[model samples]
Target chain A: MVSDNFFPQPGGVESHMYQLASKLIDRGHKVIIITHAYPGRTGVRYLTNGIKTYHVPFWTIYRETTFPTVFSFFPIFRNIVIRERIEIVHGHASLSNLCHEAILHARTMGMRTVFTDHSLFGFGEAGSILTNKLLKFTLSDVDHCICVSHTCKENCVLRASLDPSMVSVIPNAVVADNFRPLSQNEIDSRRSSAPGPPQPLGPNDTITIVVISRLFYNKGIDLLIAAIPRILASQPNVRFIVAGSGPKAIDFEQMVERNVLQDRVSLLGPVRHDEVRDVMVQGHIYLNPSLMEAFGTVIVEAASCGLYVVCTRVGGVPEVLPSHMTEFAAPEEDDLVAATNRAVAKLRSGKVRTDLFHNQVKQMYSWTDVAQRTERVYDSISTTRSFALIDRLKRYYGCGIWAGKLFCMCAVVDYLLFIFLEIFAPRERIDVCKDWPKKAVPVAKLGEEEDVESLKEGGVPGRKRNSRHRREKRDETDESSAA
Target chain B: MTTLITILTRLASPPPQTLHTHQPTSSTVTYTVTTRPALTGLCAKLGFYVGISARVVLGMVAVLVVCLKWCVSLGIGISVLGAFWGEGGERGMRRIMKLIEITDGTYIIPLAILVLFLACKRNYKEESLTIISGLGLQTSTTSSFYLRSPSTRFISTTAIQDIFIHEAFKGFEVRFYLAVVVEGEREVVVVFPSMLPRRGILEEVWREGRKCLWEMGEKG
Candidate 1:
């Protein structure tokens, strides 16, 4: 598996990639990640779980998205794909140019490809148009596509114009046990234990609202800034703890100053993910004023921390948490203020059972569940499509008018490159990296053996080595009923 | 120059860099100001207090956001209202929106080439909007940075330089209200606010601009 987002980047997509990759590796699938060089990071590095990662040096255009150099990534990528004898290429993160380039090159090389879109994009902006087109071009010939949520699948089908059948809806899973909410007794003891923490509020104490996200425009920093003053003015015994940093940082700061919320609102700036729980435990409400999302895992994380959620009703946010845990607000300034007020009122009135959110959230997600779902995706691709690269191209060719033709052309060029590389950069000549001491999947006896035999020909890259768990191999073969 | 870079470098993180630890010695009830430097703002404090339309405010903010996000220079100047000189929303009054549209349009190489095709053409058809008696860009002389709040989030909006387009061409002669297409796409409105118009043609000229825009959209 190849992915662009990994550890170091603090976002939902980044976390999803890390969790999925780690889980896949634990399932005995050899996963190698390919991402652009991040600050202070260079060359190939092995993450803790023996997962190898290659960070290619590339110029960053906006945020961490690499400058799109379409054909430039081909030569090096071809070398890696060939060296690994990779039969399948899996790309992650929609914004990563590296991921797009790999998918394009992999398709060109006649390898089965899977693309995972972690974020949802709207059809409205010009930026979305270009992004969607680029997405269309890459996905035009890919073998299969994966989306974090059903909403994201719909978005991908519309944007890339792919058939819904080929796109799998695999929601991102959170490491639920990590976020355990404090109990009332625990909260009181902790407050007392702290030698005088903000004493546990007896229903009338100040309610703390937490906002944690990058201060970018798309994150709706403008809405956050606009609503802060209104939220503070309406509720006197309310305090804000905003932890983020971006271009909108100044805008939020200005709001704080204009309202003289110096004592009331505290900007904690950016914080690490591990510390999110600690900061969240201090707050009663979690406010997410994001403009768009594919799967709002942060809201899940917030709910897991037992904070009542107040979020803009855009993208997939409305579907993330049940109404009991969250209050939905339209993506409008007035609506957001009103929703926040409602959430505060609900908290004061004891109507919202926020204390029960932690256990509920833990039940909703797990890395193991995500791994099993991903395994199903791999099964569907290999079992359903028969390693037939042409059939995969046929799936991609259904993308759109000009996009379909362009994708076929990309696939043809990649096939030609594969033949050329076979002649010049012979696979026999390149050294195959040894597997990291993983147990082999013993070919199961009986009818299950025939299915595994068929999969061997169309196996995912690094899958040929060994299936460490015979249980998973048996469980996956029984896959027709998977959701 | 050093201060500018420092200010920019600081923009990456949110306000209040040093997190307050919940310690016994810490002032839990009383809030103290963070040690962040109170560097002069890129705009005046009172500027953001009053309401400014997206057209005006976004234009001024674009000078920085674009420079940071796109790594390009954009010159935005706004002046008071005057007579229409045919540039219409594309140039004078809606400079911010126009600039965004143009930049977004030109950002793609294919669209850039398309725009280049329009730029090369010499003479073209011209249509008229309402021959306004007076209409101009709400232009303002650019102000240097002043009184910037240190604990701000997102973009530090600079003081607005409103460029108003006068309604000079709002009531004008039919003949003077000419719509000329430059290159392949751009339509320029060249009526001057200072230019005298023929009597009783104002309403006709006003009607023509809308018709022209509608016609262009249909043709496009």
Candidate 2:
């Protein structure tokens, strides 16, 4: 997997890459991550579950996105590809420079390339226009594309002009175990354990609403600021806990001060992903005022934490949860206020069975299910024949009148660079890395051994010794699996 | 103990720089043993001196131009200010010429020679790694000048925990290195850290170094 966004940077795409990689590893697939280096974190490092990350040092120009140097990354990327004997180069995030470059190079090198678009983009903006053209160039030769939701798929298809069948909708999932709701005993113990001024909510008590999004304009921080004052005014027994920080945070702070709602509103600035549930469980309602979202994974997380969700009806948000779990509102101040009030009323009446939400969400989305679906996508693409160079050029030519030719030129240059590298740094000169010892696959799960065999058939010639070692460990693995 | 093998190879960097893997005894190996500094040859020394002189001359000329430009500007400013006080411009021009003479007369040649000497102080000598049977490994980089001793580190045989060929990211590219994991040290001691030969060379050195360090003891 290749992306600019990966841990220890937190976001939807980062967690998506990590969870999917780990789950794929659990399914007995070799997975490694390629990301640009973060400060104090460079070189090769191993994460949980033996996922090796090559933090390739690159210049980051904006917001953790690596500066786009088109062919400069080819040598190192090619070295990594050869070292890992990688068959499929899975790239994530549309905006990631490393992903786009990897996709272009992977296609040039005759390796299967897969791209996952994590966010939605509009075609009207100038930035989106440029991004859309670039996306079209990369997706023109991509083996398959994955989007987090059907809305995202449609948006991506329209923006990139890709064939509908080539795109698959695989929703992002949360680790439900990490976002579990506090048990009744745990909540009672906490209330009795700490003698704080704030107490646990009883029937007809003050309703605590939670807002946990980064305070950016697109996240609807202004709408949140406007709705909070009115929501508190209309609902006398309501409190707000906003738990993120950004440029719009000062606006939120001023809203709290101007309304003199300091006692009721608490701002827990910039909570980590792991601590999200702890904040969620303290509230009766979860408010998401995002102006645009590809797939609102956090609302599902809030639902999993047993908080009744109040979200704006924006891109991919309505399709995430059922009507019973959330109260949807148009992205406006009054509607949000009304929605929060309605959710608060429901929580007061005890009509929503939030206690069962965790189980329902657990059944709704899972990384295992996502990995299985993604594996099917991989299997389908593996069976289909890849495009020839001429065919790839033709596809690039169809992107647009001017951009098409420019893209073809880029592909030609990238191909020439590949040829040059083949002569300059031959494959034999590069060392093949030792594979991480895989977890034992159970006998029942070995039904898809054909894929593994096919991958091994495409492995590097230098990997014979490692394969022999694996063969020797087969019996040990079987014993462990059997036990 | 007797001599086992000797493989003479070139460093991966460039030509004329060589690496020698010599096992004088059965359980000892010395690599990259250069008898003279890289700049010791007559032509190389002449070329080095010429390059340094040219750079120093260019630097001095650049300094002269900059200083002259500054003095001209300062002289003009002083003359303009002096004219307001009924002082003559000849005095300012004389002062600027004296300042120029002070800079150009005494300090330029000595400063240039000092800079040249300092530039020659860089280590243009080869680095070597030596391993003996019971005594551990010693890594050294020879200094170009005799005034400074070579920087060397010796890890005792017992303290030498492990040796392996590893690859890591350096700058924008991946490089192969032979690293020694010394006991109780957090960072591995990188053998041939500066030269950073290719994987083939590092693997050979790793195999030979390990055999000389530990495997021969086991066989005995």
Candidate 3:
């Protein structure tokens, strides 16, 4: 996986990469991550489950995104690709400069490339125009593209002008075990225990609505600020627990102070990823008033934590959760207020069966299912013939009048640089690294272990036998020398 | 002299290191020459000097143009020249011309030469790992310039701990290097710090060095 976002930096893409890579490793595929080095985190490090990561040193310009020095990353990237014997270069995130460069260089080196678009872009803004141009350049010749949702796929297809068949919709999944709701036994014990805070809400009890998103303008924080006071005023039994911090947080604070609703509104600034479940279980309703989203993995997580989701109907948010579990609203203050009231009424009336949401969500989305789908993508791309230089240039030339020629020139120059590297730093001289020792799958996961064994049997018989024979011969030599 | 083996390897940079193993008398001397002959031909040196001179001249001309355009008006330019040639005229003009010539030759030319020299210079001319049977290990680095003496350390057979090839992150990528862990030292001494050859070369060195050290240990 190649991306600018990875672990130690928390975001949807980072967790998505981690989960997918680890799950792919579980399916007997050797996975490695290539990302720019974070502060004090340069070098090759091994994450859990033997996923080797090469943190290439890079200059980060803003918000952990590397400066787009197109050709400068080629040498080091080529070295890593050669050393790892990488067959497929999978790039993630449209905003990542490293991902774009890797996709270009991988194509130059005649390797199959896959790109995943995680966010949606509009065709109207200048920033989006530039980003769309870049997306067109990189996705012009990519083997296949993956988007987090159907809406995201359409947006990416429109932005890059890609064939709909070449793009697949693979939703991001939450680790269900991590986002599990409070069990009935735990809830009952909390309620029956002496002198403790109320655990379960009565019919007339104060319903705590949870809002856990970065308070930004695009997140519809202004609508949230407007809706909060009205929701509290109309529904005397409703309160709010807001988490996350951003520029618009001051607006929320001012709104709360202006309304004298300090006792009802509690602000928990910037909760970590692991603590999201604990916060989610405290509320009966989860509110996500974002202006736009690609997948909205957080709502699935909220539903898994047994909270009824009240979200804006924008981008891909409507497609994420089932209608029964979610209350959708337009991106307006009054609509959001109505949605939250509806959710609160449903919760009070005991009409929504939130207690069973965890199991249903687990059945609906899983990393295992995502990994299987991604493997199918990899399998399909592996068989598809890669385009030659001329064909690739032709495709690039169809992007725009001026951009087409510019992209063609860039591809031609990248190909020349590849040829230069191949001649000067010959591939024979670059040493292939030994793979990290694979851990034996625990007996608890016997089904997966058997599946992997079967996959090995069905996949590359000669290479597997050759490596085993080499190991046996080495052992024999060691034994002979000992004797 | 009987040469046992020779290995040639290149680093990320252009210059290649050639490792030579000599089995003379009872000792094994394995040394690598890291310094390639600097700017070999006279034509190359002349070309480099000419290029530097052209760059310096062009830079001076650009600076003069920019100064004339932005820093000084045409009247000031002529007045400055007039001041140089007008008052205390001949002697001052001659002295200023001499100062310019001296500055050109002494300052800029030598600075360029120093840069060329530094670019061509290596910290160590050669590094060697010697194993005399029953006498432990000896590693030395010969200085490229005469300003610093060669650094040599001999680990007695008893003090020698272990020699192995290890992988480390150098700059942007992971690299393989050979290191010697002394008996009591906190840090292991890297064998070749400057020219870190590939893993194949490092593995060969590790195997041969360990065999020489341990085989002799058993014999003695």
User: How far off is each candidate at the interface, as Cα RMSD in Å?
Assistant: 33.0, 9.9, 10.2
Question: How close to the true structure is residue A236 of candidate 2, measured as C-alpha lDDT?
Answer: 82
Return the clash pairs for model 3, or none: none
Candidate 2 residue-wise lDDT, A321-433, digit = tens: 99999999999988988888888877777788888899999999999999999999888888888788999999999988999999999999999998767665667656787
Among incorrect, acceptable, medium and high, the docking class of model 2 is incorrect
Q: Model 2: how far is A224 from its true place, Å?
A: 0.7
lDDT for each residue of candidate 1 in B1-220, tens digit (9 for 90 to 100): 6665455445542333121112232111111112233335756434433323333453444343343224322333222211233446544446543454456533544544444333332221111122111221111111122222222111111211111111111211011222222222222333322221221232233233323334333454
lDDT by residue (tens digit), candidate 1, A247-341: 88998888888878899889998887778888888889999999988888888989998899999887767777788898998999999999999
Can you rank all candidates by lDDT, best first? 2, 3, 1
TM-score of 1: 0.59
| Model 2: native contacts recovered, as a fraction | 0.31
Candidate 2 lDDT tens digits, B1-220: 1121111111222323456787788888899844334666799899878976776676665555454545455666444434544645677666755665456534655665565566445435578999888878899887775357878999998897667665688754677677777777767798877777766566667656766788788887
Error of 2 at A253 (Å): 0.5
Ranking by DockQ: 2, 3, 1
By TM-score rank, best first, the candidates go 3, 2, 1
RMSD to the hidden true structure, all candidates: 31.3, 14.3, 13.2
Q: How many residue pairs clash in each candidate?
A: 73, 0, 0
In candidate 3, position B31 carries an lDDT of 52
lDDT of 3 by residue, A84-141 (tens): 8999999999999999999999999989999999999989999899999999999999
Per-residue lDDT, model 3, residue A463, is 30
Docking level for model 3:
incorrect
Candidate 2 C-alpha error for residue A364, in Å: 1.3
